[model samples]
Target: MNVVILSRQQAVERVGYSLGLDGSGLNGELSPALVGQALRRATSILAPCARYELERSVRQTLQPLGSPGDVVGPMVQDVLESLIVYRDLLEMRSTADEVWASAEVTIRPAAPSFVKREDGSIAVLGTAGDVITPIPEDLPARLVHRGALRLLVPTSAEPLAPRLQEFGLVELSEKAWLRLPRVEPAGNYVEEWHRRLREAPIGNRPEGLLICKPTRRGTLYRDRWNPAEVGETGLFVARRPQRFGANLWCLVDLQPNSTARIVDLFSTGDTLRSCDVAWQIQMALDARAGLAQAFRCRPNGDRSTIDFFSPIPSWAERRLFLVGRRQAGTGCLYSYEMATTAADGERRFLRESLWLVEQN
Candidate 1:
């Protein structure tokens, strides 16, 4: 039997038809313009590397089913081709480019049920009332990455523990996990976090021992460099003791529904803007607080939240914590809960756990 191989274009088109993209429109044929538009959007969202990844995923999924023109070729082609379309949609909706870059996109014919990792990786959590088998290690990098992070696998998949361990991933029963590095403390420093909490007008300070403090404050959105016109404000802080870790806090005014910078940040899918905000805050903090040494900061996790739709008050606050420190071969972990309340009585809570370590 002579096996018929599929060209890359044919494979992509077959996948598109499987995804119902071919005749979903008024015309019986899928528009080339539509495919081009989707491709352009996917490229914008995933960068040029997306094509490489998508092609790889398609080949991997279809290789086991047989040749393109075999008895099961059409069935396999549909499955593989739909994945390509699904990848484009997922990329379009995703907010973080780094997460999408690291993710191995997959789709099952069945319903969706999965556990999401702190770093944004996901694994099947098993379907209700059914024992689910573990996915093969053929796509291990997509499903798991190197790190001492927690996992959320189902009981039925417990048999795959050895393989998961070999891959450097583990499942934890604890509800919270931290992945921060550690660093040596500077030793000489004022207890600014303690004092500020005592003096803050936020009523009675919560009783977990003040471990962090804001080192500086500035406006997140400003026009014409006028401090008086600054409606949005941000704060910066380094994790206590070790001067290596830092955090950023921003309070944006959402008044008159026009001055809301928080809305602007959430709409553009440019969440990296938070990193820029954090860096600016860190620089300001170092200059104002006169720290012994300035520790370099970078984003550690894919955890972030935005709530601007509910009947918000005149302003909203956003915070980013960056920790990179390690000490004596042990990683340092920090946990905190941030609570923000709007003037109109809307409240939101953010729980954070990060590991601190030095940058290599």
Candidate 2:
């Protein structure tokens, strides 16, 4: 069956009715003015994504009248389409004192959409879908790690790694595993980590350590580390520990420098699994830092990933950093590493980099 796509106008009208706009205005039909008002309202909400803002606005606006009828489904679809049309016009404003303070920013596509020119700066595609702005050569380092561009792309689309490689922009990949250092006992750093862990707010606390063992049941390997296996065993250990299993043992050691080291045995997992580990650690760090709408990347590279992360207001900080800046902005760069043992007992190391970009 062929699918039907709604035009931008139809989408706006459908979304209006869903939000209880009544479809009556100066023109007798859903006026562009009313649709514009609703769009502005959704923009004000500034959800993690445009779709989220539409759904939330619909619910909040209609809540007083009670649940919406069957129109809710098509209305959501229409609102989403409208959001895409206005994406370029939507500005993400930051309250940060340093750069981007009170400045409105727009979300620009990255990778295949943006490319590096010979001058070392990146060429950004204009609204007309052509390269117009050339990001300074020095700006890539600042932007790659600091500038927030949604890295997640659809699997059905082309893989970005190859395109990035053409421009020497593939900073982290499967090969990054070669440069990671071996994990060792944290020693005195453990005490300092314990103190920080205690001082951290209860909501940000990480769960107890997880231990996993790998076993070979023919050619396939299965992990035997289940939370249930921990049983009544205490997570906190004061001294050096021996192997927890015959083939694989995983240990998380916290250091005084606000870093964690995860030691694992049997590290033959694929790149996808390693990415999952990196994403998990990034989420934990974002939560601890009180950043809202943290971007979570799937282990398998696919189109399912969203391209942006947003920070919500917390109790202490009323304003959020909306742009990428070196000194004080919402953009942050983080790296995580893990050491794994091979079936032959040879240790292999892996590392992954994460960028959390603030969005409207």
Q: Which structure among the candidates has the greatest lDDT? A: 2
**RMSD to native, candidate 1:** 19.8
Model 2, 1-360: lDDT tens digits are 998786544555565555434343222333333433344445444432334445556545533332323344344444433333222123232334535232222222222234332123332221222321123343322332112121122234434444444644433321231222233323323343345445543321124443322222111111323331323322232112333311222334444433344333112322122222323333334333444223322222221212222221110010011111112222332211111111011111111123233232
Q: Which consecutive 10 residues in model 2 have the weakest lDDT in total? A: 315-324
User: What is each predicted model's overall lDDT from 0 to 1?
Assistant: 0.28, 0.30
When summed lDDT is taken over every stretch of 10 residues in candidate 1, the lowest stretch is 309-318
The digit string of per-residue lDDT tens for model 1 on 51-161 reads 345434434544443334544333333333322322212222233554534332222222223333322334332211121223443542233211111123333333444
The regions of model 2 sitting more than 4 angstroms off are 1-41, 45-55, 58-193, 198-360
Stretches of model 1 off by over 4 angstroms after superposition: 1-10, 13-159, 167-360
